[model samples]
Target chain A: MMGLLETAKISLRSLWANKMRSGLAILGVIIGVGAVIAMIAVGRGASLQIESHISSMGSNILIIVPGTTTSGGVRMGAGTQQSLSLDDAIAIEEECSAVSHVSPELSGVAQVVYGNRNWSTGVIGTTEGMMDVHNWSVSSGRFLTDQDVRSSTKVAVIGETVAYELFGSANPVGEIIRIKKVPFQVVGVLAPKGQSAFGSDQDDVIFVPVTTAQKRLFGTPFPRMVRRISVKARDAESIYLAQEQITALLRQRHRIGPNQDDDFTVRNLTQAMEAAQQSTQAMTLLLGAIASVSLLVGGIGIMNIMLVSVTERTREIGIRMAVGARPRDIRLQFLIEAFLLSVIGGIAGIALGALLSQTLVLLFDWSTSISPSSILLAFGFSGFVGVFFGFYPAYKASLMDPIEALRYE
Target chain B: MALIEAEGVRKVYRMDGVTVEALKGVTFSINEGEFVAIMGPSGSGKSTLMHILGCLDVPTSGRYLLGGVDVGSLSRDGLAGIRNSKIGFVFQGFNLLQRMSALENVELPMLYGGVPSRERAEKALAALKTVGLEERKGHRPNQLSGGQQQRVAIARALVNDPPLILADEPTGNLDTKTSVEVMELLVSLNEEHGKTIVLVTHEPDIASFSKRIIRVLDGSISSDEVVIKHDGIA
Candidate 1:
């Protein structure tokens, strides 16, 4: 057993002896670890973005809209028929076991006039339950009340974008806004939500009472008809049951047959959102796996160079053995040489990978997050690669008969 | 007391399924501070005998004792320890590590023996000074002449101050001028330093430098005789 400093000195000298060869080997490891880190960062970033997007859309949610209408054999698309209404929304919320909350909505795009500054945005009429259904909150003032909806009060809550547009930086809760020249008092501002998965600005809408939108703002032909209903289930796992319950209850209420076409469609956005999230997670795994292939190639490269170094230094081994070096000493010297290569390469690769991820964020506007665990994993794996590949070469050097090795050219 | 003893030592090699008796039964003993040479033709088993005596190889069926420790009973690592502390070797090729400095080359055995760095360096420099090459301690093997390289090898063999020093044709690659210089150095190491010296060479001029000569033929000693003392160098 050689002293620690002695082994280190020997390994360092050997590595320094052939700078070009050692550099090339270290470069292989650098590229390998770097690819693993950068690829995983990008994938993790995308998945996190999707996660936030899904959360903004709210979870365990179902949106039901009116089915198509056929006029003179000309079929219209979804939401053409005014089949879903305030009554159906109330019945489902009250009757369905899996259903927790519901908000019947009548939405229309209208020009809003506030203090002579005008902006056109979608205005949805709903009750206070809209906040519970969307998991939304008010940043200032208060949301639309049940009293406001029942009395058809012209009170409204604006979103951040609409508030910023009409009121600038000033608070808009105490201001009055007009929709179709019908004045409504601003009651509160919805908290800012950056973007939806559909790439739409979620902070660009307004909410008012359903009765007011049907009666005052955008008048409908039917008395209590609504355009859509957003329903929330008890929890994530009960969404399927909630969707089924909604369909069965609606079909029975609308007097539709089992085999016949229904007047409304119950759509589950949470399932689609979850599927998107799952695919992004898969993409993360896929990126890491692909990058690890390069790492494997790098390990093989290490083994190849080590074998060459052993063959080149056969005479050195013989000389050392002649000077009373044990077989373990010879084996350990070369093993340490390789271990140093990989450990140094691993550190450099981690730095390179982080830099690469930052570069991607800067140039491509891609979101990237470097997890510390990945760094640890990469470092540990690289060290393992070094020792693993170095073993055979070191073993071969140790097993050489000293007399024969001395005689080798 | 005998510092090195061999009794009926033998070595057999099986290469390509052909048995070759590298050494037949041979026996000898050398006391402390004695200088001897084993002289023979090529393939006459002089080198094989040297390897066994140096503990680099074990005898097939005999007893070899270094400092009264039975060599045949030792493990490979035990042999290594004995070689490190009790014996040193010098080869014809001046077997110094090519990339290492002369000082570092000399420090190798102590490095393996786990001697602390500061003391190892001091002892290695002292050994280099003994060979009169302390100033060339930093020079690599390629930077030195053949005689200077052999001196460096001798310094390396002496750094640990082993009781026994073995030279296997130490001057085989040197000129007559360099050969005489090396032989004189070995003579002084035995006379002044009280180191036991065993040399293997084919040239009678080289053999005469030792106090005794053992001649080998066909894997066995043909004759053993004393070398009459004279002006030994050259």
Candidate 2:
């Protein structure tokens, strides 16, 4: 039996002797492993980014929008019917044990003017609970109190984009802004939320009390009515339960009988976000699979070089065999040579991948994360590739006829 | 017991569907401590016989035995074990790994025998000393003369203290002076060390160094004779 140490030493010596050729052979593996790591890192980063966006949108939250209302057989889209209202949102929060917070909204696109600047942005009239439902916080001053909503105060909490457009670098708080020519005082600035999952700017809206919106800024078509209701479940697991309870309660309140088409739709944003996340995960897998092909190509390259090396060193093998080295010893030496090549490539490729990831972040502001599992995967896979690809050449070398090999020119 | 034996041994080669008999049912035996040379021209089957005797190749027909054990029936690994512990091979090209130092090359046989490194190194060095090349152990084969490389090969063959030494034209690549030196070394190993030697060569002058000479012609042994040796001062 050949000792592993001796075989390793011999392989190292031979590979080192032909450093140039070995380096060329290992380059394929290096590129392959590097590509795998970098691609997976980028893919994981994208999914993580989406996850953060989902969390920013809030967890265990559901949005309720009115169902379509057909007018003379011309079907109107969702949110066209005045089905949901502020009273319904309040009832869900008070009645359903699964429902934690509620924020009913009456929102529209409107032009707001402050100083010499005028900008068109989303104007959303919601209660103080909107902050908790959306997981949003105030950057400065304070959010709306319940008293402000009840009193129908002419006040606003503007988002970062809205603040930037209206007040530039100056503080928007304590300043008054006109919405449809009606002045409303700025109370606080909403903390920045970059972009939504749908690629819409999130920090380009202003939040006012629902009462103030109905009375002052944008009048509603009916009293106690709202366009949508944002409901937060007590926990992530109870989101579906909360949705069911809300649906049942709304159906009973609206006096809809069994099998009657509902006048409202309850959407669990968590489910939508999960679906989006699943697609991202699939994208990541696809990227890894594509990168794996390069890794496979690299394994093939190792095999090609190993076959050539065996052919080149036929006499060397004969000499070893003549000296009483068994076929297994020769096989082991060649296998070790191939295994060492890929392992070396794996180590170097990891370093290269990390460098590439960092370069991407620096050059393109892409978020890249190299998970420990990905590293392990690339390294283990490369080693396996070495053994897998090295097998054929080692077998060929072992089965050689000593006399014939020695006689080979 | 006879240290080497061949009974009706024949080797046939089939290449591109052409059958060529390299050895024809020949039989021979050599006891312990004898130096025998097999002489032949190219394609005379001397090399093939040497290979079979060394356990590097198995005969197509008949039993070839080493130390009363039929080697033809042994498995590949079994043959390897016999070759490793019983026979040392000295090839015409001096078959030392080019990049290894003389000591490393000498250590090859002992390495396969699974000897510990310290002992292997000691034995390799002693073998090199016997060949009068102990001081050149640090030099690689390419750095040494052809005769020096052959000495390393001989040291490698002798490292395991094998009972038999097989040389396939051991001095074929050396000059006259170097050939004489290598032959004297082999003669000393046979006489002073009691090693059974089987050598393949075509030169009558070189064959004269052995106790017995066997000449092969057209795949058959034509002559087997005891040589008249000239006395050497050493």
Candidate 3:
């Protein structure tokens, strides 16, 4: 039996003798592994970005929007019927055991003027519970207080983008900003949350007290009209229980019969986010599986080259056998040669794929995460490909008749 | 015991559904430290006999023994071990790997025998010195003359210090002058080292170098004769 290092040395020497053939043979492996790495990296990065966006909204969150309505045979979407109220949010917070916090929101797009600059942005009205429900914290000053909501104080908290646009690197706290021509003092600036999954800018918004928005800014004819209610469950596991409890409570409060659909829609954002994650994961696996076919094709290439090598080295095989190389030794020599080709190709592919991924990040701004497991999977898979593909040819070489092979021209 | 013994050995080759009898009921024996030459025409099965002796091929119906072990029942790997430790081969074409140096070619047999690297190198160098090619140990086959390559082959055959050496037209590719030189080298290996040698050749001049000459005719041994020492080492 040949030692491992000796077999490797012989294989390397033979490969070096046929440098061009060996290089071309391993090219397939290189491309296959590289493609697998790059595709998986992009998919993982996209999923991670989505998960961050979902968590930024809040953990274990549910958004309740007013149900659809119809006017003159035209059906409107959710939030069209203003059935959600601040009292319902308070009821959910007090009566639902799984509920952690609740915030009633009345939001609209409006032009906010500060000093001499005016910018059109989303304006949200809620209580101090808004910060808790949305997992948001102020970078400067304080969020709206419960007293501000109860007394209907004219105070606003600006998001990072709104602060940037209205203040231009200056502190905006204690300054007055006019929302819909109603003057409100800036109480805080929110820490930046970049973008939502819907591609809307999360930082380009302003927040005010819900009572002030309903009484002074919006001036709705209805007394307790609310557009949406955001709720947080006690923990991730209790989100469904919270949803069920809130649904029962709202159905009773609206006086809807058992046969009738409730007037409001409760959406579990956590469940929706989880479903999205599952789909993305499926897509990643699919992409990875498709890319793995290239590795098999690369294996076929190795087999083809190894067959040619066995034929080319027929005389050499005979000579080694006559000099006392056993069948296993001969087989191991060729196997090691194939393994070397694939492993070297795998390492090279990783380097190449990483370079390409970084280039994508720079040129196209596409996120790519090269995880360690993926690298290990790709490298180990390439080694398997080598052993699998190289076996037939190596076996053929080992089985050659020494007498006949020695006589071969 | 004889170094090699064969009794009623036969080799029949099947080619395209037709059987060709290469060796027919051949029987022979050679003692240790004896130099024997097998001589025949192209179709006389002398090469077939040489292959069987070298453990390169198994006979179809045979009782052959090498160093008191039955060779016919040996497995492929068993035969390989015998080839590594008990028998050495010298071929007409100087079958050296093109990429390896003379020293590496000489060390190959010992390597298969699992010799350590340091001792393998030392013994290979010593064998090369025996063949008077020690200075050309670093040269590849293409860089050496035909005679030097054959000397390298001889060094390779002697590296493991096998009891038996099998040569098949070892000097066939050489000029008359070089053939004499190689024959002399083999003669001295047998005479000075007490190594047993068996060689296949068609030329009477090559066969005359051995102590005993066996001539094969029609797949059977036709004549066997011992050279008289009266000629005083031809």
Please identify which of the two predictions, 2 or 3, would achieve the higher DockQ against the true structure: 3
Model 1 CA lDDT for position B169? 97
Off by over 4 Å in 2: A67-82, A94-100, A106-132, A136-221, A233-265, B15-19, B231-234
What is the per-residue lDDT of model 3 for residues A1-409, given as tens digits with 9 covering 90 to 100? 6688988998999999999999999999998899889889988998998799788988899999999999999989887987888899889889999999999999888999998999999988898889999988999999999899889899999999999998999999999999999999999999988888888899999999998889877766597777899999999889989999999999999899999988999998878888888898898899889889998898899999999999998999999999999899899999999999999999998987788789889999998899999999999999999999999999999999999899988
Per-candidate TM-scores read 0.96, 0.85, 0.94
Q: Candidate 2 lDDT, tens digit per residue, A52-112?
A: 9888999999999998999999999998999888889889989999999999999999999
Which candidate tops TM-score? 1
Query: Each model: TM-score of chain B?
Result: 0.98, 0.97, 0.97
Over 4 Å off, model 3: A110-120, A168-185, A235-237, B16-21, B229-234
lDDT of 3 at A191: 93
Q: How close is each model in CA RMSD to the real structure?
A: 1.9, 4.2, 2.4
B84-129, model 3: which lDDT tens digit per residue?
A: 9998899998999999999999989887888988999999999999
At residue A292, give the lDDT of candidate 1: 82
In model 2, what are the clashing residue pairs, if there are any? none
Model 3 lDDT, residue A408, Cα:
84
